[model samples]
Every structure is written in C-alpha cells, then in structure tokens.
Target: MTDLPFDPIQLMREHPEKMHIPGGLLTKQGPQDYVGGVPAITGTLFFNDAHTAEVREAICACFDEYEVIAKAHLTWLWRAEPPEGPDKFVYEKAPSMRAMIKRMNENDLVSFTYVSGKQPHDAGDWEFQVFGRRGWEAKMIVRGTSALRFTMPLLHVEKNPAAFQAMFVSFAKRLKALHGYGGQGLVLSAPRESDNQPFEAYLANMLNGLDVGEPVGATRSAHLGIKTVSWLTAVNHKMIEKIGGLSAIRSELPMDWFALYDYGAGLVVQAGPKPEGAPADQPKPARLVLPNMLFKEVRAPKVSLHYASKEGEPRLIGWGAEQWLQRFDVPEDEVQAYKARLLDEPKLTKATTLPDRL
Candidate 1:
C-alpha cells in the first residue's frame, strides 16, 4: 500500500508504440525524467462563482501541509493566449504562485501541475494538480458554475485515509462545494490532451472502480449533480434533501461500515475503511453495492469517457463508453435481487487477481 500498484509513466515508456503523438512527446525522454507515474486519488469540488481568493488560500494551505513544493521538481502553469502564453509558463518561488492566483479574473482559468520527486528531475514518485475556473458560467459553452480539482498520488491516501478524508472535508467546507466524488483514478502525463485517455479506458474496464474521465469535463456536465460514486462522495445540503434527508440516507447505508462526516456546507459519505477497486478477474464488487444504491438515489447519470485510441489498442468510446458507465447500474425492478447477489458474493482475497501484471 506504500506504493502504487503500477507505474503509469513506466507503461508509456515500455510501450511507446502504444502512446499517441503530441502529448506523448513529453514521455519521449523515458519515465524517469517526467514526474507522473503513480495511480491517483482525486477530489473535484464544484461550487458557485467567484471565490478564487479563498480557493487560492486553501490550495496554499494544502501545499504547505504536504510540503508539495519541497518535493516537486517541475511546476507548470497553464494560460490561454499571448501575454499569458507563447509557451508553457513555468514558475518558481511561492510569492509568484500566490500572485498568479490573486490576479485571476472572472472566467479566468487557474491551472497548476506539480511533479514531485525526492531529487530534482528524478522519476516522479507523486504528482499533484490544481485546476479551477473562476466564474465559469459566463465563459464555458456547457455553462458550468465553478470548480476546484485536486489530484494526489494514491500512495498518500493509502498511507492515511483519515487524513485524506479530513483534507477533502476542509476543501468542501471552504469551497462550499455543491457535490463531488473521490477515489481511485488515473492521472494523465499530459492531462489537457486526449492521448492518455485510451489507456485510461482500457484500465478502467479492467478496474471497474477507477474513474477515468477528466475532472474539468465532469464539472461542466455534472453541475450541481452527482458524477459517480466513489470511496468519498460529498453532497451539499440541497442535494441531501433531494436524496431524502441525512437520516434516510443513513438508514439505508448501514452505520456499521459507512461513515458520514459533516463538512458544514455538506456531508461526505465514506463507503468503507478505504477505497476499493475490483479488477475484472476478481469476484464481482460486492463492496460497491451500497455506494451504487446511493448513486441511483442521487440520480447520477452515465458519465462519458474519452474515445480516441491508437490503431488497434483497447478502446472505450461511443457505445462502449455508455456500457462502462452503466456497469454498476441496477434496474428498478431488479434492485432487491441485484443487491442480494452482490451482498452475498465473496470478498477479494490474497488470491484475487491484480492488474499489476497487465
């Protein structure tokens, strides 16, 4: 648990033929040069417009708590056009970071990617990303409000789930988040590009619990709604009411295993002691039954995943993407029967198949 199940960056390096162009150019130097490789635990918080100041402070606090900069070799900033960009903007020093965030205007994008390693330019052991769109409603074609997203290495969460939960709650309260989900997921080497998604879809199919879609895209489509259930699912006061009161939810999700933590603005529902990912070869994920029930109650829609792929690699797009999203959905009439079957299934064990060998 101290390490990722597999090194994603290494996968790209070992299978360069499998990688797409442009975005995959960053990996041309091999896995050890770039920062990202580990599987990630991501949290995406959505809220109303104009709270960039608070979000900036929260990010700083989080970085300070984790000593993110001390371990990071590369820090990237994304900008739209001239004055803001001619090439990728790379900055050093905390003062500049704070200034960059402070000057952000309405509808302006705030993006940062930190590549962390024990030594400068060393193979990245962990990767962290921050993305938010201030007053996005006026700018985005999809009409999204505003969102703050964080991606942390899975090793960190595996080390301390409690601490991770606390950090998430802290963010939800400060951002006054409307809704969000956090758990196992893949972090792209070049997140802004579509290159890594084909690989993501392949992995997601094998590891059904992993969320493979881009967080910013989810923010646009799932405004004030649930995206998908995960280890930690947060819903605001308004959403809690729509899904039946807190008590009603609590009654359905047994208190013995499911822990509900209040974050002032909303509450986070923790499915179990830790995040769970059921590999395709393993027994059906009985663990997800309760979470899926919540997903149904919240009326979460089938999420979309990127479709672009290499010549003959595994692809999840169009109708394929639709099937992946509905994998956990149980029909209304079959809910009881489905729950019974899932609940009675055996748990994953030492013999359970793992995706590491793939």
Candidate 2:
C-alpha cells in the first residue's frame, strides 16, 4: 500500500483532544467538550462453526440484558493467509485494507442500529450518532485465519475499573461455556482516559509516555532512563555513607561478580554470590544487572530478554536487552576485560568493597 501523508502536528492542531498536545495551548474548553461519552470494548475470538450459533445467541443475550451497554454488535472476520508459507504474512494492501475495514464498519454499524431498534434521535449531532454506530466490521482480509469480533459501547461502567473487570469476566464465563472447555478468547477495552482514538494509537502513546504537555515520547523516555540511573547511583552512595561506607555493606551481603557479556547496545553483568547447596556442576544463580545508562532504547517486534529463574527454567522478559541497558553508565572499553576476568581467569581474592564504579 502507498504511504499516505500523516501529519501528526496538523492533526493535533485540528483535533486537540485526539492528538497529544499541551493543555495550555488548547482553547478554554469545558469538561463536556473533551468528554468521551462511552467507552467501546472490542475484541476478537477464534472458534470453529460448531459453536457459532450458541456464541452469537449468548453475545446478543448479554448485550440485551446488560443495561450498561448502550449499543453493541458482533461479526465474523474472514482472513486470508499467504499460500507460500506461514512466514511472510505481510499483504501488499494491508494499510488500505485496514482503512477500508474501518470505513465499512462505520457504515454497517449505522444500518445495523436502525434495523435493531436503536435509531438515533438527532441525526445532526454527529458525535451522538457516531457513538451508537461504533462497532467492528465483518470482512475478508489478507493475513491470519478467520475469527469473531464483538464491539460494545459501555455506559457509565467505563469509569469504574472493578465494575468493568467483573462485567467482562462474567461475559467471558458465559462465552466459555458455549465455546467449550479449552477454547481461546480475549477481551479488549480502552481505558477511561483514552479519548476515542484508535486503541493501538492510545496504547502506543501511553507506552512512550507521551501525554499532554509531556516531552515527545521516545526521546523523553530515554532522557528519564538516564536520569533515573544517575539518581539511583547517588542514592546508593549516600546509603553506603550512612551505613559506614561500602565495606560495611559488602561484609554483610557478600556479593561477587560471576560473568559479564555485551548484550545489545550495553553490557549485562551477572552479580550476587552463588546460591547455597546443590550439585557442584550446577551454574550459579545471579541477577542480571545492566551497567550502561546511555544505550539507545531498542523497540522492535518479536525481540525480548530471557533470564534464568532461581528455581525453574529460564523465563522471558518482555523488554529486550537493549532497552534494559539504558539503566546504567558503564564504559565500553572496560566491558571486554570485565568478561575475561569473570569467565576465563581464576578467582584472585575476596574484597570487602563494592565493584569498581562505572
């Protein structure tokens, strides 16, 4: 698909509430101006034709009985996968397909509402009209397999997290019974603060820490990470001083460096003394420590960090090694020598002081 021009700045100027912009710069607006009337809860569930009728009935019944839902709709999605293999799933017109699906959803929702006895009182009031007509679309798209999607316009229940959780849990339970014992399902809902933007965009802004008047997302996050490490180091020094210096703490804790390795953009040092008991051949359990604060934060698809547990096998950490490296300030040249000493060289002597400063 051709890349359409997307000017976030222009969007922010026109639709201040939708984009992340400063409050001071915005017009003097009241609560009603920015109030997103009702939250839309939308998600997809995958199941075969065996449970289709029962699932649809349960969903419709749930919407009908639940007074909290102002309007709701459920539909099936037909997805087409690449015939070559499961590896390359990217379609040529993927973006266009998404845009088309969104438009079709809006149009279909309007027709569905009218047929279902929830016609809007004021057609001129675009906001109110659109609210009742917000739902997911049923369409064939290139990528993945077929699934069912449900969209619900939640009433005042959006303001209360506990109530929303309970509602979804009950809804899930009812669907689970119809889908049978081990069927897969998921519930998606936007937070109360999210102002009617695409759910993906809202989540992206949140993870990048971009809110009103805040610094531009990723850059701000990187700066804050550096500051955090500096602050923590200063605090560590002060605490050492208060407790009669590093020597005193070291005597009690007795930590020893085990191994060091260059992980992504920074270095990771395995620290802490070997665990007590067990077989001699067993590897020591040490905490993975980041030792560089200036490393560039890496955010990529399907990349993460794996760390061994104290008891069980290794577990995956969501953020990658590069992102984790942003929490320290170790020098580049010292990394190789540190690794050599910890892994190749024999133990020299035990000292009652902290590891050398970065």
Candidate 3:
C-alpha cells in the first residue's frame, strides 16, 4: 500500500518536502482509485460574529487540541507579508504558530491556510484553513461570514472519533457557530482551484453521504440556513429557535435514532455511529431519509458550484451542481409518503439493533 500513489502519508513521511499534491496523485492513479482511496475527513464551522479576541483564542485552542491527536500534522502556514497590511493572499512562512495566531487576531479579514508539509504548498497529509470575513458589516451587502475549517486523515478519526467530536463541540461552544457539518469530505490539493474537481464532482454526484464542501462559498451562501447535513450537524441557539427549539426537534427526530449533544450555545446532532458515503445511484433512499427530513427543515439558502469546467472535460457545474445539492430533496407530492414511512419505522431499542432507516 505504501507503494501506491494514493498513500500521501507514506510519501510525506519519506521526504517531507518532496510530497505530491492531490492533483499530482490523481494523475498517477485511476479515477476510482483516486477518489475511493483518498484518506481525508473534513470538518467546518461558520461563525456570524467576527474573529474577536475570545473567538480567536478558542480557535487556536481547538487547533492545539487537534494537533495533540494528529501529532504535528500542521507544520507551515501561508501568511501574507506585513501581517496587518491590506487584503493580500500570499503564502509567507510564519515565525511561529503563536506569532501567526497573534497576527490573525489583529486583522479584521484574514485568510490563513496551514499545511502539514515543510514547504508551503507541499501535498501534506493534513490542512487547516481560517477565512475571516469579519469586516463585512460595513459593506452595503454582506457577502461572506467568517469560517474555520480543517481536514485530516480518516485513520485518526476512526481511532478516536470521541476526541474529534469533543474538539468539534468545543469549537461550537466557543465560536458560537451559526451552523456547521462534518464527516467524510474530500481534501483537495488546491482547495480554491484544483485539478481534482472533475473527479470530486463525479463522486459527489454518486455519494449521498459524502460532504461536497467549500468553506468560503458555504460561509457566503449559507447565511440564511445550513448547507447540508452530515454525520455530525451543529446548529446554534438562533437556528434551533427558527425550527421551533429543542423540544420540537426532539419530537420530530426520535432520540433513539439520533444522538443530540448540547454545546452551551448550540446542539450537535449525530446521525449514526460511523460516517457513511452511501451510493447516490442506489434505488432506495433508506439511509438518507432521516437526515433528509432535517435538511428540508433547515433548507439551505443556496448551493454554490463547487467545480469549474475546463473547455471540454467532464464536470458538474451550473444546473448540474445545484441538482446534486438537492439530491435528497423529496418532491412536494412525495413529502407525505416519506413522512408516513418515517412514522411507521420502529426505533431501535437494543444496543445492537440497527438505527431506524427513516
């Protein structure tokens, strides 16, 4: 397996500076091997408020906690010169993690990307991004909100999901996240502009459970509501109130099937014991219906196009991307049918019993 092109961890460990990015890895492997074998799990949270002193501190602390478990997965950051200068996107090395965070605290709008490799843009095994649109309040129309996101190896998550969940809850508690979701997500080489998008766009269409995510667009477009539901979904107090509070949600979604955790200012709903990327081509929507109900309640404001098309290559953009985001949407006529099915399913009472497939 170490010899395989998809094994980024092995390559990174062998020659830290000479690692291949996701696009390069894809070039060396077939589409099935590339998308199916990429071992990354992503988590993102959106904040309505600015990256204030308290919020910045909490963000750094969460990163520290994650570092303890990922074991030095972050090594370098892409920082612009003159830390307090006007908006500029440059990948300069930071003097230290503490210093980099201090600079982040000073700025109103910041874009920070931390990679695991020694070099700035090396195809590291893990990555963290903090895009703050803190100064948008003064603008005529607020475009994007602040967002904090990270991607790491799935093996770490499998080994200790509790630790990761604890960290995720801490983020929601301290940051006062408006809404967020995390689970099986792709970590592209160039997240903003990557050659892997065509394949990602393909897998996104095929997998109902995979999170086809982009923090920047999500922060911008999801101002009205959540983007999508995943293994873990976090919604703040305000959002919960919109859908009739915790009591109403509990009544609609049975506790026996879904586990809900209170994180001070919000709640994190766990869909199942483990993350699943159920095939989108399947006829049955058994595993998707439960979450689909919650998704419909939240109703994502808009679904931004995740991939840009080349002159002639296969891709999902425009109408195609919008259709994929609404893949779980039940037609108005079929809504009652789905609701009836959900009501008839028995809740799992035994520890070993499978969760309700609503």
Candidate 4:
C-alpha cells in the first residue's frame, strides 16, 4: 500500500499502491509502451547547465527518489548507492513527489556531470557515474569521467511541442504514404527525459553525433536553480505552447483505448499498441491503457491534470478513475485472437475483474 507500511527498496509489485506499473518504466515481460500512456511522462533532473550551482539547487528542491545505497558495480557500468542522510531523496518519506512539487511550485532544477577514465590506469580503471535515481524498476545510468552533467527534470510525453512534434509529423506522413492506418495514437515513455527527443536526433546527437550537440539547446531548463516537483503537474497546454503544439502531429490514435491525461508540465495519452516490427514513425508502440499509479493514502494524484486546471474550472469528469487493463505484447493480427481467448470478449465490461498493479 502507498501509505500503508512497506519496505522502500523491495520489489514494487509487492506493493498495492505501485501496481499497474507504467510500461517501460517497470521491468515488464515485453517491450515498453510508447503509444499514449502515462509511462511516456518522465520527470528528469538536468545535471549540467550553463550555470551549475543553480542547477544543483533546483535538483535538491524537488523529489529525491534516489538514495545513494552504496557505490558498486551493477551489471554493466557504475551505480551509486543512495546517499546516507535524511536530506537525500526517499520515496516513502518527505521529499516525496508531492512535497517537492510544493517546494518547487514556480521553479525547476538542473545538475551537471562528467565522465572520465582513470588518469593513471589503462584508461578503464574507474569511471564517474550519475544515476537518474528514477523510479525503482526502470532507471537512467550515465557514465563518464569529467565534464558537464545535466540533471534532467524531464517528463517524456508525446512529441516535444517544438522538435519532436515535427519528427512525429514526418513519421505520420511516411505511414500515410505506405497506406498504413490504425485506431490508436502513438505512445512513448523515455527513461531519460530527452528520450522525447526524436529517435533520429538521439542517433545524430548523442549516439552517432553527425550533428553532435545539436540537441544541447533543448536541454536547458526554464527556471535556472529553481526547483519544483509540481512542474510535472503544470498545464499540458501551456507546456505544449512553450515547446510547440499538436498541429504537426500525425501519429495514429485509436479511439477505443485512447485517453489523455494532463500531468502538469505535459499531457499523457493512454494509447493502443502498434503492429510488431514497425519503424519508429509508422504505427507507434502498442499498449494497454493503464491508469496513473496512485498512492493508497492520498485521494488525489500528486502531479495531476486537475491539479493544473485553471482556477474555478467547471466540474471535472474522467479523472482518477479506478479501471485497469491487461496489456498484450503479441502481434497485431493475433491481438484480437489472443484477447478473445484471454478476456473471452472484444471489450471490457463492469464484470471484468483486473489484477492490482504493484
């Protein structure tokens, strides 16, 4: 249970509040979801900025989900243990997503990191690392020696208004050209905040670097040194306007499972899955619509669409409802066949009892 007593570092599936884990963010059975789901919304902390201290200040102000448990070797690169202090981030205690959001009602944070090889060793002796301290299941682990570390306070939703929107537009067009169409819109969740950056951009800038550092400009935070977990709860419309808009978007959106959630700073969509082995642009990720993970003790979401609504807005509907769906990672043609056998029906009704999310 979210508020009920439980261990922090234990498997989340064991917790009542953490059930229905967002796709990709969790170590699920299959590929992560990308077509319109809260899993697409990612909150990041930028480590490196034009200004550094302001960035660190901004980062410390909000949620500290990362506790430096102990520095040691994980499977591949480096991993940092949670800091041994009350000031460090703790999911169950203070500095929660809600508390940090309250502290950062008007500001955001950034941090800087650098990776370098050990000076005296054979160039691979030791490496510096920065862990995103992302939620338990999925995480962001960066390694280097020295330079600028950008702690990204990023939420991966649909396309970024400015850049990603254009990329999605192009992908949508290519799909149209191929004569492919679908009922559900695209859904994407990035472990790192900037995963929202077009896949091409990532390949070009971060991976391939043909246009190295091309995306440097987009990583800059709006309020330097300012921090707020609430930024994640900011109005999606405003964030879309600042970043760009939906005019250029072309990804298919299926009406049945599609639902939109404005989680401050961004809007998230609950989308259907795409055909298997499709390109990044055409028929985006297929996903079963899942509800935003909630805390059992708190009645409202810590960062929610309603929390961002304008003052004195009309009565709300379709919010914080308790419905869940079982996602399938099968082929498009087989999805219906599989559903018929598993659910034994084409649609869900009040009688269907779903599993509780961990």
Please give the CA lDDT of all the candidate structures.
Answer: 0.57, 0.24, 0.60, 0.22
Clash counts for the predictions, in order: 0, 3, 0, 72
Show model 1 residue runs off by greater than 4 Å: 1-37, 50-95, 117-125, 134-142, 300-304, 307-315, 333-358
> Whose TM-score is higher: candidate 2's or candidate 3's?
3
RMSD of each: 7.8, 21.7, 6.8, 20.6
Best by TM-score: 3
Report clash pairs, candidate 2.
Answer: 292-328, 293-328, 293-329
The digit string of per-residue lDDT tens for model 2 on 1-358 reads 1121344434432442243221111112312222222213332222211113454444444444443343232211112221122211122212322232234322232111111111211111011100111222222211111122333322222243233223333443444411100001111111112222222222222222111110111121221222121101111222234445444434322234322222122222223221111111333111211222121122112222222222322122334224332322345665444444344323212331123312
Q: Where does the lowest 10-residue lDDT sum fall in candidate 4?
A: 177-186
Give the Cα-based TM-score of candidate 2 against the true structure. 0.24
* lDDT, candidate 1, 1-358, per-residue tens: 1123444444433542232222222222222333332356667666664335666676656555444423454454333331253334443543445566666665566665554433333223244455566555534535664555566655556555465676677777776777887777655654333544555665676777777676656666666367777777888887788768887777666554566778788788766666667566665454565667655666445454564554544456667877776667655676566456544544323222111211
lDDT score at residue 78, model 2, on the 0-100 scale: 17
Better of 1 and 4 by TM-score: 1
Error of 3 at 92 (Å): 14
- Per-residue C-alpha lDDT of model 3 across residues 1-358, encoded as one tens digit per residue: 1124343434423442343344422223433322222436677888865556666767777667666655456665564333564322333434444455576544355566676654444435577777766544414225756788877676666665554566677777777887888777666644333455554565566577677746776676767778777767888777788778888768656666566777777888765555656566554243356566655667665766454554444455677766766777766677557655644444334341223222
- The reply for model 2, stretches above 4 Å from the true place, is 1-44, 66-68, 71-155, 177-358
